[model samples]
Target: MSVTYLEAIREAQAYLLEHDSRVYIYGQDVGAFGGAFKATKHLANRFPGRVIDAPISEDAMIGSAVGAAIEGMRPIIEIQFADFSTVGLNQVVNQAATLFWRTETPCPITLRLPSGGTSGGGPFHSQCLESIYAHFPGLVVCTPATVEDAYSMLIESVTLDDPVIFCEHKYLYYHLKAESLPKDALPLGKARIARAGRDCTVVTYSAMLHECLEAAEEMSAEGIELEVVDLRTVKPLDTDTIIASVARTGRLLCAAEGWPWGGVNAEVISRVVAEGFNLLDAPPQRINAKDTPIPYHPKLWSVHRPAAASIMAAVRNVLRS
Candidate 1:
């Protein structure tokens, strides 16, 4: 039987709860309601008291989870949406992100953000906040593109003794599927070469990886090879793998679902220029969501975020440059 990306996430939580007594779940409507996307469906019943329902306040949720982590408990906190996480920005950045640095206490807390845009989700419910979280110190921001990574990385996040931002795209919850969960995966902080090519590289993460892969398949008939790299974790970025991909392809195109300015795209390009300037045959290019609020209309939302055709155009532009 095939497992979808959403199911894989649920399995990961199940794994954590069954294996680790210290690991508990805290979120809004998670106990009986099973979460906004039902990612935590039935976990409350299966794990009994381990799965809890938090107050509607995002700040309180993170704050309480932080305290739990301090007392040697690993807490998996789920925000209803990526945009709502902003409400707990202070706790994440100042408290959880700084716990280790300030007093050497391990804040083993996992914040699962159902990120990225879905049709009609609008600005409030849909957003990609990976770049914002990745900017801070002592936080590991993971963007799992595949079903396997979604399961494995989340499990890994709970195991680590630091704050982890789990950016699981909402679009892939039902759109993507896998035959089975991976027994072994590339270690966290490493990238995967989703598709290899010699002409140019497309560096992306999360749901954007699907669009880049689609672009790669479509452009193959035109004799334009496109290499695609899935940066599994945005914060602890794998610069070595990314630079090597650029060295082989001689060009880079960074595509992301977030806005273009100062995002993962910009971070990748800056690193390549600083550390692998000699490897590029041409300047790197990027394509991202337009600089505006996420539109509610499906038609406008489709064009707002980077898609296969837009990724194709960016890749072609980089190759031509």
Candidate 2:
């Protein structure tokens, strides 16, 4: 049976609640209202005291989750919109990120950020800030591409000793679907190749992975084969798999839902260039959202972000170069 991306996320939450008594979820409208995306729909009724609805203050919600994690509870805190995470920067960066450094208290707090564009959420609602969390040392940032990974990574994230920024793409919430997920899963730090090829390597995650896959299939018909590597875990990135792919194809292109300046692509391109610079026919390229906020109207939305055509152009440029 096929399961949508939202269903996979719901499964992950339900599994955590059933498997671990210490695992609790707190966010805006996450309980009775079942969250803005309804990923937690009916979960409040299922887990009476566990699925809590917090106030609109992201700072307070993160602070509460941090305190709970310190006291031996695995708290999964949702920021509602990834854009609103700016208000809770202190709790995320200074407090939750440095809890172990300050003392021996392991903050097993999972910050679930519903991020990325494509929903016409404007500047105030949609944004990809995973790179901001990646700047910190103690946080484990993850953005799974497939349904199976979305289902399993959430479980693995809650079990981690450090804080994790679990980024869920709003664009991919229900767009992606897969037949029954695997009962057993891989570790959190691994990357998966959605499509194998001997040509250029297209590194992407979240909603952009689907675009890359579509572009790759289209490009394949034109005799330009491209391998798609989904970086499931963004923070502790699987550099080994990335470098190996680059070594095989001798070229790489990164497509992320983040801004062009100082995003995950910069970090990934830097690592590849520093370690695997020799394994390139041309300098690595990236297809990222423009360095601006997402617009509201559908007409202006196309100008703010990268699309399949943009990614295909980049891949073709790599091939031509």
Candidate 3:
């Protein structure tokens, strides 16, 4: 039987709950409601007290999770929406992120943010804040693109010594699926070459990875091969892998679902230009969501985010350059 990205996440949490007594889930509507997207469906009953619900306050949830982490517990704080995480930004960036540096204690908390845009989700419900959290020090930011990574990375995030920002794309929850859950997975910080090519390199993560792959496939028929790299974790970015791909292709294009300014796309292009300047035959390019609030209209939302057509156009521009 095939497994979906959402099911993989739920199973991963189940695995964590079963193996670790210290691991507990804390979030709004997470207990009986099974999270905003049902990523935690039936987990509360299955795990009992470990899957307790929290109040509506994001700050309180994060603060309490940090406290639990300090007291020898691993807490997974599921913010209902990625956009709502801003309410608890202080606790996440200040306390959980700086705990190990300030004190000798390890803050092992996994903050799950249901990220990315779904049709008509609007600005409040749809946002990708991986880059914002990645900007802070002492935090691991993971953006799992596939069902396998979704299952495996969540388990890894909880076991880490530092805090983690787990960005699980809401768009991929049901849209992406796999034949089976992975038995083993690549380490968290490593990047995966989703497709191999020589004409150009497309580095992307989360939901945008699928778009790049689709664009690559379309371009292949036209004799333009595009190599696609999935940067699983944006913070601990695999620069070596990205550089290697650029080395082979000599052209780079970064695509992301986030906004254009200072996003994951910009970071990838900046790194390639800085370290692999000589390896490139052309200037690296990037495509991101339009610099505006996510629109409520389905048609407007579709064009707001980077899609296969946009990625293909960007690839062509890089090739022409």
Q: Write the per-residue lDDT of candidate 3 for residues 187-292, one digit (tens) a residue.
A: 9899999999999999999999999999999999999999999999998999999999999999999999998899788888888889999999998889999999
User: Model 2, residue 102: displacement in angstroms?
Assistant: 2.1
Candidate 2 regions with alpha-carbon error over 4 angstroms? none
Model 1 residue 171 CA deviation (Å) reads 0.2
Query: How much is 66 displaced in model 3, in angstroms?
Result: 0.7
lDDT of 1 by residue, 71-113 (tens): 9999999998889999999999999999999999999999999
lDDT of each: 0.94, 0.89, 0.94
How many angstroms is residue 36 displaced in model 1 relative to the true structure, after the best TM-score fit?
1.4
lDDT of 3: 0.94
**What does candidate 2's lDDT look like per residue over 217-279, in tens digits?**
898898888999999988899999999999999999999878888878999999999999999
Report the lDDT of model 1 for residue 140.
Answer: 98
Question: Roughly what TM-score does model 3 have, to 2 decimal places?
Answer: 0.99
Give the worst 10-residue stretch by lDDT in candidate 1.
Answer: 312-321
